[model samples]
Target: MTTAPTPVPTPAATELSGGAGASGTATPVPRRRTVKLRGGSWLATVPLFAFFAISFGLPAIAIAIGAFTLSSDAETGAGTFTTQNVTDSVQGAYWTSLLSSVKLSALTALIGTVLGLPIAQAVVTSRFRAVREAVLSASGVLANFGGLPLAFAFVATLGNAGEITKLFHLTDHGWSLYSFTGLTIVYLYFLVPLMVLSITPALDGLRVQWREAAHNNRATTLQYWRHVALPILFPSLLGGYVLLFGSAFAAYATAAAMVGATVPLISRSIADALSGNVLVGQGNLALALSLDMIVVAVVVMAVYLPLQRRSARWLS
Candidate 1:
Protein backbone atom coordinates (compact mmCIF):
# COMPACT_ATOMS: atom_id res chain seq x y z
CA MET A 1 0.00 0.00 0.00
CA THR A 2 1.25 3.48 -0.95
CA THR A 3 1.48 6.05 1.84
CA ALA A 4 -0.14 9.41 1.32
CA PRO A 5 2.30 12.33 1.05
CA THR A 6 2.50 14.65 4.08
CA PRO A 7 0.65 17.93 3.49
CA VAL A 8 2.65 21.15 3.69
CA PRO A 9 1.28 23.85 5.99
CA THR A 10 0.98 27.42 4.68
CA PRO A 11 3.70 30.04 5.45
CA ALA A 12 1.30 31.94 7.66
CA ALA A 13 0.67 28.89 9.83
CA THR A 14 4.43 28.16 9.90
CA GLU A 15 5.12 31.74 10.96
CA LEU A 16 2.49 31.51 13.70
CA SER A 17 4.18 28.35 14.92
CA GLY A 18 7.51 30.27 15.05
CA GLY A 19 8.85 28.86 11.74
CA ALA A 20 10.70 25.55 12.24
CA GLY A 21 14.01 27.04 10.93
CA ALA A 22 16.57 24.43 12.10
CA SER A 23 16.16 20.72 12.94
CA GLY A 24 14.33 21.44 16.21
CA THR A 25 14.83 25.16 16.51
CA ALA A 26 12.01 27.69 16.02
CA THR A 27 12.77 31.29 14.96
CA PRO A 28 10.79 33.97 16.77
CA VAL A 29 9.36 36.99 14.96
CA PRO A 30 10.26 40.36 16.43
CA ARG A 31 7.14 42.36 17.35
CA ARG A 32 6.86 45.75 15.68
CA ARG A 33 5.60 48.76 17.61
CA THR A 34 2.13 50.09 16.71
CA VAL A 35 2.14 53.12 14.41
CA LYS A 36 1.14 56.41 16.01
CA LEU A 37 -0.53 59.31 14.23
CA ARG A 38 1.52 62.52 14.13
CA GLY A 39 0.27 65.69 15.86
CA GLY A 40 0.03 67.29 12.37
CA SER A 41 -2.57 64.74 11.31
CA TRP A 42 -4.63 65.46 14.45
CA LEU A 43 -4.19 69.20 13.85
CA ALA A 44 -5.45 68.80 10.25
CA THR A 45 -8.75 67.35 11.51
CA VAL A 46 -9.27 70.26 13.95
CA PRO A 47 -10.48 72.57 11.13
CA LEU A 48 -12.96 69.95 9.87
CA PHE A 49 -14.24 69.34 13.38
CA ALA A 50 -14.44 73.07 13.98
CA PHE A 51 -16.41 73.55 10.75
CA PHE A 52 -18.98 70.98 11.81
CA ALA A 53 -19.08 72.39 15.34
CA ILE A 54 -19.67 75.94 14.10
CA SER A 55 -22.08 75.20 11.30
CA PHE A 56 -24.09 72.32 12.71
CA GLY A 57 -23.47 71.57 16.37
CA LEU A 58 -23.39 75.20 17.53
CA PRO A 59 -26.69 76.11 15.84
CA ALA A 60 -28.44 73.03 17.19
CA ILE A 61 -27.07 73.69 20.70
CA ALA A 62 -28.08 77.36 20.45
CA ILE A 63 -31.63 76.40 19.52
CA ALA A 64 -31.80 73.94 22.41
CA ILE A 65 -30.56 76.58 24.86
CA GLY A 66 -32.88 79.26 23.49
CA ALA A 67 -35.83 76.92 23.92
CA PHE A 68 -35.23 77.02 27.69
CA THR A 69 -34.28 80.71 27.96
CA LEU A 70 -36.73 83.51 28.70
CA SER A 71 -36.57 86.69 26.60
CA SER A 72 -36.02 90.15 28.14
CA ASP A 73 -39.24 92.17 28.54
CA ALA A 74 -39.84 95.64 30.10
CA GLU A 75 -40.16 93.90 33.48
CA THR A 76 -37.17 91.60 33.05
CA GLY A 77 -33.79 93.33 32.55
CA ALA A 78 -31.67 91.91 29.69
CA GLY A 79 -32.27 88.13 29.74
CA THR A 80 -33.73 85.53 32.09
CA PHE A 81 -33.93 81.75 32.45
CA THR A 82 -37.17 79.86 33.03
CA THR A 83 -38.95 76.59 32.08
CA GLN A 84 -42.08 78.58 31.14
CA ASN A 85 -41.20 78.49 27.43
CA VAL A 86 -41.31 74.70 27.39
CA THR A 87 -44.42 74.71 29.63
CA ASP A 88 -46.20 77.19 27.38
CA SER A 89 -45.39 75.10 24.29
CA VAL A 90 -46.61 71.88 25.89
CA GLN A 91 -49.83 73.41 27.24
CA GLY A 92 -51.10 75.34 24.20
CA ALA A 93 -51.49 74.81 20.43
CA TYR A 94 -48.35 72.69 20.44
CA TRP A 95 -50.19 69.80 22.08
CA THR A 96 -52.93 69.82 19.46
CA SER A 97 -50.41 70.09 16.61
CA LEU A 98 -48.38 67.21 18.03
CA LEU A 99 -51.46 65.04 18.32
CA SER A 100 -52.51 65.92 14.76
CA SER A 101 -48.99 65.15 13.49
CA VAL A 102 -48.90 61.72 15.13
CA LYS A 103 -52.36 60.82 13.75
CA LEU A 104 -51.47 61.98 10.23
CA SER A 105 -48.18 60.10 10.29
CA ALA A 106 -50.00 56.88 11.22
CA LEU A 107 -52.57 57.39 8.43
CA THR A 108 -49.90 58.21 5.85
CA ALA A 109 -47.90 55.08 6.74
CA LEU A 110 -50.99 52.86 6.45
CA ILE A 111 -52.02 54.40 3.14
CA GLY A 112 -48.52 54.18 1.65
CA THR A 113 -48.00 50.53 2.59
CA VAL A 114 -51.47 49.50 1.39
CA LEU A 115 -51.05 51.36 -1.90
CA GLY A 116 -47.36 50.59 -2.56
CA LEU A 117 -47.63 46.81 -2.08
CA PRO A 118 -50.14 46.45 -4.91
CA ILE A 119 -48.04 48.68 -7.16
CA ALA A 120 -44.88 46.71 -6.34
CA GLN A 121 -46.75 43.44 -7.06
CA ALA A 122 -47.89 44.86 -10.38
CA VAL A 123 -44.33 45.91 -11.28
CA VAL A 124 -42.98 42.46 -10.42
CA THR A 125 -45.69 40.19 -11.85
CA SER A 126 -47.15 42.19 -14.75
CA ARG A 127 -46.59 40.88 -18.27
CA PHE A 128 -46.16 44.17 -20.11
CA ARG A 129 -42.67 45.73 -20.04
CA ALA A 130 -43.87 49.19 -21.21
CA VAL A 131 -46.45 49.33 -18.44
CA ARG A 132 -43.87 48.41 -15.78
CA GLU A 133 -41.39 51.00 -17.06
CA ALA A 134 -44.08 53.66 -17.30
CA VAL A 135 -45.32 52.96 -13.79
CA LEU A 136 -41.79 52.97 -12.31
CA SER A 137 -40.80 56.13 -14.22
CA ALA A 138 -43.99 57.87 -13.23
CA SER A 139 -43.41 56.91 -9.61
CA GLY A 140 -39.89 58.31 -9.79
CA VAL A 141 -41.12 61.55 -11.32
CA LEU A 142 -43.91 62.02 -8.81
CA ALA A 143 -41.61 61.16 -5.90
CA ASN A 144 -39.43 64.11 -6.87
CA PHE A 145 -42.48 66.30 -7.63
CA GLY A 146 -43.37 67.05 -3.99
CA GLY A 147 -43.88 70.36 -2.03
CA LEU A 148 -45.48 73.32 -3.91
CA PRO A 149 -45.66 71.75 -7.37
CA LEU A 150 -47.54 68.73 -6.04
CA ALA A 151 -49.98 70.97 -4.17
CA PHE A 152 -50.73 72.95 -7.36
CA ALA A 153 -51.20 69.72 -9.32
CA PHE A 154 -53.75 68.54 -6.75
CA VAL A 155 -55.42 71.94 -6.92
CA ALA A 156 -55.52 71.89 -10.73
CA THR A 157 -56.83 68.35 -10.77
CA LEU A 158 -59.26 68.41 -7.81
CA GLY A 159 -59.68 71.93 -6.45
CA ASN A 160 -62.95 73.89 -6.67
CA ALA A 161 -63.63 74.83 -10.32
CA GLY A 162 -60.29 73.23 -11.34
CA GLU A 163 -59.86 72.02 -14.92
CA ILE A 164 -61.10 68.55 -14.01
CA THR A 165 -64.12 70.06 -12.26
CA LYS A 166 -64.93 72.38 -15.20
CA LEU A 167 -64.29 69.84 -17.95
CA PHE A 168 -65.33 66.53 -16.35
CA HIS A 169 -67.47 67.61 -13.36
CA LEU A 170 -64.84 66.30 -10.91
CA THR A 171 -65.70 68.76 -8.17
CA ASP A 172 -63.47 69.10 -5.15
CA HIS A 173 -66.72 67.61 -3.84
CA GLY A 174 -66.31 65.68 -0.56
CA TRP A 175 -62.53 65.64 -1.10
CA SER A 176 -61.68 69.28 -0.45
CA LEU A 177 -58.02 70.39 -0.94
CA TYR A 178 -57.91 72.08 2.46
CA SER A 179 -58.38 69.17 4.87
CA PHE A 180 -56.20 66.67 6.76
CA THR A 181 -57.46 63.96 4.37
CA GLY A 182 -56.17 66.05 1.46
CA LEU A 183 -52.69 66.24 3.04
CA THR A 184 -52.79 62.48 3.65
CA ILE A 185 -53.48 61.91 -0.07
CA VAL A 186 -50.62 64.23 -1.08
CA TYR A 187 -48.27 62.51 1.41
CA LEU A 188 -49.22 59.11 -0.03
CA TYR A 189 -48.34 60.30 -3.52
CA PHE A 190 -44.68 60.68 -2.46
CA LEU A 191 -44.76 57.98 0.21
CA VAL A 192 -45.92 55.13 -2.06
CA PRO A 193 -42.93 55.62 -4.35
CA LEU A 194 -40.66 55.49 -1.30
CA MET A 195 -42.30 52.22 -0.23
CA VAL A 196 -41.98 50.74 -3.72
CA LEU A 197 -38.28 51.56 -3.86
CA SER A 198 -37.68 50.12 -0.38
CA ILE A 199 -39.76 46.95 -0.71
CA THR A 200 -38.93 46.03 -4.34
CA PRO A 201 -35.43 44.84 -3.40
CA ALA A 202 -36.87 42.64 -0.65
CA LEU A 203 -39.41 41.21 -3.09
CA ASP A 204 -36.73 40.66 -5.75
CA GLY A 205 -34.60 38.76 -3.23
CA LEU A 206 -37.31 36.05 -2.98
CA ARG A 207 -35.53 33.17 -4.73
CA VAL A 208 -37.13 31.37 -7.65
CA GLN A 209 -35.86 28.01 -6.32
CA TRP A 210 -37.85 28.45 -3.10
CA ARG A 211 -41.03 29.16 -5.05
CA GLU A 212 -40.41 26.23 -7.41
CA ALA A 213 -39.67 23.90 -4.53
CA ALA A 214 -42.84 25.00 -2.76
CA HIS A 215 -44.83 24.50 -5.99
CA ASN A 216 -43.37 21.00 -6.54
CA ASN A 217 -44.65 20.15 -3.10
CA ARG A 218 -48.15 21.14 -4.39
CA ALA A 219 -48.10 24.57 -2.78
CA THR A 220 -50.50 27.13 -4.27
CA THR A 221 -49.18 30.62 -5.18
CA LEU A 222 -50.80 32.12 -2.12
CA GLN A 223 -49.61 29.22 0.00
CA TYR A 224 -46.06 29.64 -1.28
CA TRP A 225 -46.14 33.36 -0.50
CA ARG A 226 -47.69 32.78 2.89
CA HIS A 227 -45.22 30.08 3.93
CA VAL A 228 -42.00 31.02 2.14
CA ALA A 229 -42.22 34.67 0.99
CA LEU A 230 -44.02 36.80 3.59
CA PRO A 231 -41.85 35.64 6.49
CA ILE A 232 -38.81 37.00 4.65
CA LEU A 233 -40.57 40.13 3.35
CA PHE A 234 -42.22 41.23 6.65
CA PRO A 235 -39.14 42.84 8.22
CA SER A 236 -38.48 44.88 5.07
CA LEU A 237 -42.13 46.00 4.89
CA LEU A 238 -42.02 47.10 8.54
CA GLY A 239 -38.81 49.02 7.94
CA GLY A 240 -40.36 50.73 4.90
CA TYR A 241 -43.42 51.69 6.94
CA VAL A 242 -41.19 53.29 9.56
CA LEU A 243 -39.36 55.20 6.84
CA LEU A 244 -42.61 56.44 5.24
CA PHE A 245 -43.86 57.52 8.65
CA GLY A 246 -40.73 59.61 9.20
CA SER A 247 -40.93 61.18 5.72
CA ALA A 248 -44.56 62.22 6.12
CA PHE A 249 -43.98 63.41 9.67
CA ALA A 250 -41.18 65.77 8.56
CA ALA A 251 -43.02 67.13 5.50
CA TYR A 252 -43.60 70.91 5.57
CA ALA A 253 -44.03 72.71 2.24
CA THR A 254 -46.78 70.48 0.83
CA ALA A 255 -48.86 70.82 4.00
CA ALA A 256 -48.26 74.58 3.97
CA ALA A 257 -49.40 75.01 0.35
CA MET A 258 -52.47 72.84 0.83
CA VAL A 259 -53.74 74.25 4.15
CA GLY A 260 -52.42 77.86 3.78
CA ALA A 261 -52.22 78.29 7.60
CA THR A 262 -55.59 76.93 8.75
CA VAL A 263 -54.63 73.32 9.70
CA PRO A 264 -51.72 73.07 12.12
CA LEU A 265 -49.72 69.96 11.40
CA ILE A 266 -46.44 69.94 13.39
CA SER A 267 -44.31 71.22 10.54
CA ARG A 268 -46.80 73.97 9.60
CA SER A 269 -47.11 74.91 13.25
CA ILE A 270 -43.31 75.14 13.61
CA ALA A 271 -42.97 77.29 10.48
CA ASP A 272 -45.65 79.64 11.73
CA ALA A 273 -43.96 79.94 15.10
CA LEU A 274 -40.62 80.65 13.40
CA SER A 275 -41.87 83.09 10.76
CA GLY A 276 -41.74 85.70 13.62
CA ASN A 277 -45.09 86.96 12.35
CA VAL A 278 -47.22 85.69 15.24
CA LEU A 279 -44.53 84.75 17.75
CA VAL A 280 -41.78 87.38 17.24
CA GLY A 281 -39.44 87.03 20.22
CA GLN A 282 -41.10 83.74 21.10
CA GLY A 283 -38.97 81.81 18.58
CA ASN A 284 -38.48 79.52 21.55
CA LEU A 285 -41.84 77.97 20.64
CA ALA A 286 -40.35 77.00 17.29
CA LEU A 287 -37.35 75.52 19.10
CA ALA A 288 -39.65 73.61 21.42
CA LEU A 289 -41.57 72.44 18.35
CA SER A 290 -38.26 71.35 16.84
CA LEU A 291 -37.53 69.45 20.03
CA ASP A 292 -40.92 67.69 19.70
CA MET A 293 -40.06 66.85 16.10
CA ILE A 294 -36.70 65.56 17.26
CA VAL A 295 -38.45 63.25 19.71
CA VAL A 296 -40.60 61.83 16.90
CA ALA A 297 -37.50 61.44 14.71
CA VAL A 298 -35.68 59.65 17.52
CA VAL A 299 -38.57 57.20 17.95
CA VAL A 300 -38.60 56.46 14.22
CA MET A 301 -34.84 56.01 14.24
CA ALA A 302 -35.01 53.72 17.28
CA VAL A 303 -37.59 51.53 15.49
CA TYR A 304 -35.56 51.64 12.28
CA LEU A 305 -32.40 50.25 13.92
CA PRO A 306 -34.04 46.96 14.94
CA LEU A 307 -35.89 46.65 11.65
CA GLN A 308 -32.58 47.14 9.82
CA ARG A 309 -30.94 44.50 12.01
CA ARG A 310 -33.81 42.11 11.19
CA SER A 311 -33.43 42.89 7.47
CA ALA A 312 -29.71 42.18 7.59
CA ARG A 313 -30.30 38.90 9.43
CA TRP A 314 -32.97 37.89 6.89
CA LEU A 315 -30.81 38.85 3.90
CA SER A 316 -27.85 36.98 5.32
Candidate 2:
Protein backbone atom coordinates (compact mmCIF):
# COMPACT_ATOMS: atom_id res chain seq x y z
CA MET A 1 0.00 0.00 0.00
CA THR A 2 2.94 2.32 0.46
CA THR A 3 4.20 1.63 -3.08
CA ALA A 4 4.53 4.56 -5.46
CA PRO A 5 1.16 5.54 -6.93
CA THR A 6 0.76 5.65 -10.79
CA PRO A 7 1.19 9.24 -12.05
CA VAL A 8 -2.24 10.80 -13.07
CA PRO A 9 -2.45 12.94 -16.19
CA THR A 10 -2.96 16.69 -15.50
CA PRO A 11 -6.14 18.53 -16.76
CA ALA A 12 -3.97 20.56 -19.24
CA ALA A 13 -2.51 17.31 -20.68
CA THR A 14 -6.04 15.82 -20.94
CA GLU A 15 -7.24 18.97 -22.80
CA LEU A 16 -4.24 18.83 -25.16
CA SER A 17 -5.15 15.19 -25.78
CA GLY A 18 -8.65 16.35 -26.79
CA GLY A 19 -10.31 14.92 -23.66
CA ALA A 20 -9.70 11.63 -21.84
CA GLY A 21 -10.59 8.54 -23.84
CA ALA A 22 -10.66 4.89 -22.90
CA SER A 23 -7.90 4.22 -25.50
CA GLY A 24 -5.93 7.33 -24.29
CA THR A 25 -5.58 8.48 -27.94
CA ALA A 26 -5.81 12.18 -28.95
CA THR A 27 -8.64 13.15 -31.34
CA PRO A 28 -7.61 15.01 -34.50
CA VAL A 29 -8.56 18.73 -34.67
CA PRO A 30 -10.29 19.98 -37.83
CA ARG A 31 -8.66 22.96 -39.49
CA ARG A 32 -10.82 26.13 -39.68
CA ARG A 33 -11.57 27.64 -43.06
CA THR A 34 -11.15 31.42 -43.52
CA VAL A 35 -13.76 32.92 -45.82
CA LYS A 36 -12.86 35.90 -48.03
CA LEU A 37 -15.61 38.53 -47.88
CA ARG A 38 -14.23 41.32 -50.07
CA GLY A 39 -14.88 40.39 -53.71
CA GLY A 40 -18.45 39.12 -53.55
CA SER A 41 -20.01 42.41 -52.38
CA TRP A 42 -20.14 43.80 -55.92
CA LEU A 43 -21.66 40.58 -57.30
CA ALA A 44 -25.14 41.69 -56.30
CA THR A 45 -24.90 44.85 -58.36
CA VAL A 46 -23.83 43.12 -61.58
CA PRO A 47 -27.36 42.65 -62.85
CA LEU A 48 -28.28 46.24 -62.13
CA PHE A 49 -25.13 47.53 -63.84
CA ALA A 50 -25.79 45.35 -66.87
CA PHE A 51 -29.37 46.55 -67.12
CA PHE A 52 -28.33 50.20 -66.87
CA ALA A 53 -25.68 49.70 -69.53
CA ILE A 54 -28.06 48.06 -71.99
CA SER A 55 -31.03 50.34 -71.38
CA PHE A 56 -29.55 53.76 -70.75
CA GLY A 57 -25.79 53.83 -71.25
CA LEU A 58 -25.72 52.17 -74.68
CA PRO A 59 -28.60 54.29 -76.03
CA ALA A 60 -27.06 57.47 -74.64
CA ILE A 61 -23.71 56.66 -76.24
CA ALA A 62 -25.33 55.90 -79.57
CA ILE A 63 -27.28 59.15 -79.41
CA ALA A 64 -24.17 61.18 -78.62
CA ILE A 65 -22.15 59.56 -81.40
CA GLY A 66 -24.99 59.84 -83.89
CA ALA A 67 -25.52 63.51 -83.01
CA PHE A 68 -21.95 64.36 -84.04
CA THR A 69 -22.11 62.35 -87.27
CA LEU A 70 -23.80 62.99 -90.61
CA SER A 71 -25.13 60.52 -93.13
CA SER A 72 -22.96 60.42 -96.26
CA ASP A 73 -25.83 59.25 -98.47
CA ALA A 74 -29.32 57.83 -98.00
CA GLU A 75 -28.53 54.82 -100.18
CA THR A 76 -25.11 54.07 -98.73
CA GLY A 77 -26.17 54.84 -95.14
CA ALA A 78 -22.64 55.89 -94.24
CA GLY A 79 -21.89 58.37 -91.45
CA THR A 80 -19.31 61.18 -91.47
CA PHE A 81 -18.28 63.41 -88.55
CA THR A 82 -19.96 66.81 -88.39
CA THR A 83 -21.19 69.47 -85.93
CA GLN A 84 -23.89 70.98 -88.18
CA ASN A 85 -26.58 68.96 -86.44
CA VAL A 86 -25.73 70.60 -83.13
CA THR A 87 -25.80 74.05 -84.74
CA ASP A 88 -29.08 73.30 -86.52
CA SER A 89 -30.65 72.08 -83.26
CA VAL A 90 -30.03 75.48 -81.63
CA GLN A 91 -31.17 77.62 -84.54
CA GLY A 92 -34.37 78.38 -86.50
CA ALA A 93 -37.66 76.60 -85.68
CA TYR A 94 -35.88 73.97 -83.61
CA TRP A 95 -34.73 76.66 -81.18
CA THR A 96 -38.27 77.96 -80.91
CA SER A 97 -39.51 74.48 -80.11
CA LEU A 98 -36.95 74.20 -77.35
CA LEU A 99 -38.06 77.51 -75.91
CA SER A 100 -41.69 76.43 -76.07
CA SER A 101 -40.87 73.23 -74.21
CA VAL A 102 -39.04 75.23 -71.55
CA LYS A 103 -41.98 77.59 -71.13
CA LEU A 104 -44.50 74.76 -70.87
CA SER A 105 -42.39 72.95 -68.28
CA ALA A 106 -41.95 76.10 -66.19
CA LEU A 107 -45.63 76.96 -66.28
CA THR A 108 -46.71 73.45 -65.32
CA ALA A 109 -44.15 73.24 -62.52
CA LEU A 110 -45.30 76.57 -61.09
CA ILE A 111 -49.00 75.77 -61.28
CA GLY A 112 -48.52 72.23 -59.95
CA THR A 113 -46.50 73.45 -56.95
CA VAL A 114 -49.03 76.13 -56.06
CA LEU A 115 -51.99 73.77 -56.25
CA GLY A 116 -50.25 70.71 -54.79
CA LEU A 117 -48.74 72.31 -51.68
CA PRO A 118 -52.15 73.00 -50.12
CA ILE A 119 -53.42 69.51 -50.88
CA ALA A 120 -50.30 67.98 -49.37
CA GLN A 121 -50.57 70.19 -46.29
CA ALA A 122 -54.23 69.29 -45.91
CA VAL A 123 -53.50 65.60 -46.22
CA VAL A 124 -50.68 65.83 -43.71
CA THR A 125 -52.88 67.59 -41.15
CA SER A 126 -56.02 65.54 -41.81
CA ARG A 127 -57.70 63.94 -38.77
CA PHE A 128 -58.97 61.00 -40.76
CA ARG A 129 -56.53 58.21 -41.64
CA ALA A 130 -58.89 57.00 -44.39
CA VAL A 131 -58.85 60.41 -46.05
CA ARG A 132 -55.04 60.56 -45.91
CA GLU A 133 -54.77 57.05 -47.37
CA ALA A 134 -57.29 57.86 -50.12
CA VAL A 135 -55.54 61.08 -51.09
CA LEU A 136 -52.14 59.38 -51.25
CA SER A 137 -53.50 56.43 -53.24
CA ALA A 138 -55.25 58.72 -55.74
CA SER A 139 -52.19 60.90 -56.02
CA GLY A 140 -50.01 57.88 -56.77
CA VAL A 141 -52.34 56.69 -59.51
CA LEU A 142 -52.89 60.12 -61.07
CA ALA A 143 -49.23 61.04 -60.90
CA ASN A 144 -48.26 58.22 -63.26
CA PHE A 145 -51.57 58.21 -65.18
CA GLY A 146 -50.16 59.56 -68.44
CA GLY A 147 -49.45 58.34 -72.01
CA LEU A 148 -51.95 57.54 -74.81
CA PRO A 149 -54.80 56.51 -72.54
CA LEU A 150 -54.46 59.70 -70.52
CA ALA A 151 -54.54 61.73 -73.72
CA PHE A 152 -57.63 59.88 -74.95
CA ALA A 153 -59.36 60.40 -71.64
CA PHE A 154 -58.62 64.13 -71.76
CA VAL A 155 -59.75 64.36 -75.40
CA ALA A 156 -63.00 62.57 -74.54
CA THR A 157 -63.56 64.83 -71.56
CA LEU A 158 -62.46 68.18 -72.97
CA GLY A 159 -62.22 67.91 -76.76
CA ASN A 160 -64.64 69.69 -79.11
CA ALA A 161 -67.04 66.76 -78.99
CA GLY A 162 -66.32 66.32 -75.28
CA GLU A 163 -68.93 66.74 -72.57
CA ILE A 164 -67.30 69.81 -71.05
CA THR A 165 -66.97 71.46 -74.46
CA LYS A 166 -70.61 70.75 -75.27
CA LEU A 167 -71.66 72.05 -71.89
CA PHE A 168 -69.63 75.24 -72.47
CA HIS A 169 -71.16 75.50 -75.96
CA LEU A 170 -74.59 75.28 -74.38
CA THR A 171 -73.60 78.25 -72.19
CA ASP A 172 -72.61 80.18 -75.36
CA HIS A 173 -68.89 79.87 -74.60
CA GLY A 174 -66.05 78.50 -76.73
CA TRP A 175 -63.34 76.04 -75.65
CA SER A 176 -60.39 74.74 -77.67
CA LEU A 177 -58.70 71.46 -76.73
CA TYR A 178 -55.99 71.61 -79.40
CA SER A 179 -54.25 74.80 -78.33
CA PHE A 180 -51.22 75.36 -76.03
CA THR A 181 -53.57 76.45 -73.27
CA GLY A 182 -55.59 73.29 -73.74
CA LEU A 183 -52.43 71.17 -73.59
CA THR A 184 -51.46 72.94 -70.40
CA ILE A 185 -54.88 72.14 -68.97
CA VAL A 186 -54.49 68.46 -69.88
CA TYR A 187 -50.98 68.47 -68.42
CA LEU A 188 -52.32 69.76 -65.14
CA TYR A 189 -54.33 66.57 -64.67
CA PHE A 190 -51.17 64.53 -64.10
CA LEU A 191 -48.85 67.37 -63.06
CA VAL A 192 -50.85 68.45 -60.02
CA PRO A 193 -50.97 64.89 -58.74
CA LEU A 194 -47.23 64.54 -59.27
CA MET A 195 -46.67 67.68 -57.23
CA VAL A 196 -48.92 66.39 -54.47
CA LEU A 197 -46.92 63.16 -54.32
CA SER A 198 -43.63 65.02 -54.35
CA ILE A 199 -44.48 67.58 -51.66
CA THR A 200 -46.48 65.37 -49.32
CA PRO A 201 -43.43 63.83 -47.65
CA ALA A 202 -41.89 67.25 -47.28
CA LEU A 203 -45.06 68.59 -45.70
CA ASP A 204 -45.18 65.60 -43.36
CA GLY A 205 -41.56 66.19 -42.42
CA LEU A 206 -42.62 69.47 -40.84
CA ARG A 207 -42.36 68.85 -37.07
CA VAL A 208 -45.26 69.66 -34.71
CA GLN A 209 -42.84 71.18 -32.20
CA TRP A 210 -42.01 73.95 -34.68
CA ARG A 211 -45.69 74.84 -34.95
CA GLU A 212 -46.08 74.72 -31.18
CA ALA A 213 -43.05 76.97 -30.78
CA ALA A 214 -44.45 79.43 -33.29
CA HIS A 215 -47.79 79.45 -31.47
CA ASN A 216 -46.03 79.94 -28.13
CA ASN A 217 -44.41 83.05 -29.61
CA ARG A 218 -47.93 84.31 -30.43
CA ALA A 219 -47.32 83.86 -34.16
CA THR A 220 -50.32 83.65 -36.49
CA THR A 221 -50.73 80.69 -38.83
CA LEU A 222 -49.74 82.71 -41.89
CA GLN A 223 -46.78 84.19 -40.04
CA TYR A 224 -45.58 80.74 -38.99
CA TRP A 225 -45.80 79.38 -42.57
CA ARG A 226 -44.30 82.49 -44.14
CA HIS A 227 -41.25 82.57 -41.91
CA VAL A 228 -40.51 79.19 -40.32
CA ALA A 229 -42.31 76.68 -42.52
CA LEU A 230 -41.68 78.24 -45.92
CA PRO A 231 -37.97 78.62 -45.31
CA ILE A 232 -37.69 74.98 -44.26
CA LEU A 233 -39.82 73.76 -47.16
CA PHE A 234 -38.30 75.98 -49.86
CA PRO A 235 -35.56 73.54 -50.84
CA SER A 236 -38.04 70.68 -51.16
CA LEU A 237 -40.41 72.94 -53.13
CA LEU A 238 -37.64 73.89 -55.57
CA GLY A 239 -36.62 70.27 -55.99
CA GLY A 240 -40.21 69.29 -56.69
CA TYR A 241 -40.44 72.10 -59.24
CA VAL A 242 -37.39 70.71 -61.04
CA LEU A 243 -38.87 67.19 -60.98
CA LEU A 244 -42.19 68.45 -62.40
CA PHE A 245 -40.38 70.48 -65.03
CA GLY A 246 -38.48 67.39 -66.18
CA SER A 247 -41.68 65.36 -66.25
CA ALA A 248 -43.48 67.88 -68.47
CA PHE A 249 -40.46 68.45 -70.67
CA ALA A 250 -39.89 64.78 -71.32
CA ALA A 251 -43.56 64.00 -71.93
CA TYR A 252 -44.14 62.79 -75.49
CA ALA A 253 -47.05 60.36 -75.83
CA THR A 254 -49.58 62.51 -73.95
CA ALA A 255 -48.83 65.63 -75.95
CA ALA A 256 -48.52 63.76 -79.25
CA ALA A 257 -51.81 61.89 -78.87
CA MET A 258 -53.65 64.90 -77.46
CA VAL A 259 -52.65 67.70 -79.86
CA GLY A 260 -50.72 65.95 -82.63
CA ALA A 261 -47.71 67.99 -83.81
CA THR A 262 -49.63 71.26 -83.52
CA VAL A 263 -47.64 72.16 -80.44
CA PRO A 264 -43.96 72.60 -81.30
CA LEU A 265 -42.47 70.96 -78.22
CA ILE A 266 -38.86 69.82 -78.44
CA SER A 267 -39.96 66.23 -77.91
CA ARG A 268 -42.45 66.51 -80.78
CA SER A 269 -39.81 68.06 -83.00
CA ILE A 270 -37.43 65.23 -82.13
CA ALA A 271 -40.11 62.74 -83.05
CA ASP A 272 -40.74 64.41 -86.37
CA ALA A 273 -37.07 64.52 -87.22
CA LEU A 274 -36.54 60.87 -86.34
CA SER A 275 -39.59 59.80 -88.37
CA GLY A 276 -37.98 61.41 -91.47
CA ASN A 277 -41.02 63.67 -91.86
CA VAL A 278 -39.00 66.87 -91.65
CA LEU A 279 -36.09 66.60 -94.08
CA VAL A 280 -33.35 64.34 -95.43
CA GLY A 281 -30.19 64.01 -93.30
CA GLN A 282 -32.23 65.09 -90.26
CA GLY A 283 -31.81 61.86 -88.32
CA ASN A 284 -28.66 63.19 -86.74
CA LEU A 285 -30.57 66.33 -85.94
CA ALA A 286 -32.98 64.18 -83.97
CA LEU A 287 -30.09 62.85 -81.95
CA ALA A 288 -28.87 66.43 -81.54
CA LEU A 289 -32.24 67.42 -80.15
CA SER A 290 -32.08 64.44 -77.84
CA LEU A 291 -28.65 65.58 -76.74
CA ASP A 292 -30.05 69.01 -76.03
CA MET A 293 -32.73 67.40 -73.89
CA ILE A 294 -30.06 65.43 -72.06
CA VAL A 295 -28.13 68.60 -71.41
CA VAL A 296 -31.21 70.39 -70.14
CA ALA A 297 -32.01 67.42 -67.93
CA VAL A 298 -28.48 67.35 -66.65
CA VAL A 299 -28.65 71.03 -65.76
CA VAL A 300 -31.99 70.55 -64.06
CA MET A 301 -30.59 67.62 -62.05
CA ALA A 302 -27.56 69.68 -61.09
CA VAL A 303 -29.84 72.33 -59.64
CA TYR A 304 -32.12 69.75 -58.07
CA LEU A 305 -29.35 67.78 -56.37
CA PRO A 306 -28.26 70.64 -54.08
CA LEU A 307 -31.81 71.57 -53.19
CA GLN A 308 -32.70 67.92 -52.54
CA ARG A 309 -29.64 67.51 -50.32
CA ARG A 310 -30.51 70.65 -48.37
CA SER A 311 -34.08 69.44 -47.98
CA ALA A 312 -32.92 66.05 -46.72
CA ARG A 313 -30.90 67.75 -43.98
CA TRP A 314 -34.13 69.01 -42.39
CA LEU A 315 -36.52 66.28 -43.51
CA SER A 316 -34.34 63.37 -42.49
Best by TM-score: 2
Model 2, 1-316: lDDT tens digits are 5999898989888778787588867676677999988869899899999999999999999999999998887798888999999999999999999999999999988999999999899999999999999999999999999999998997888887888778768235546788799899888899898999988888989999999999999999999999999999999999889889999999999999988878889999998998878785588899999999999999988987887788789888
Clashes of each: 0, 0
**Residue pair clashes in candidate 2:** none
lDDT of each: 0.80, 0.90
lDDT by residue for model 1 over 269-316, one digit each (tens)? 787777876757667778877877777777877877876777677666
Where model 2 places Cα greater than 4 Å from the true spot, the runs are 1-41, 170-174
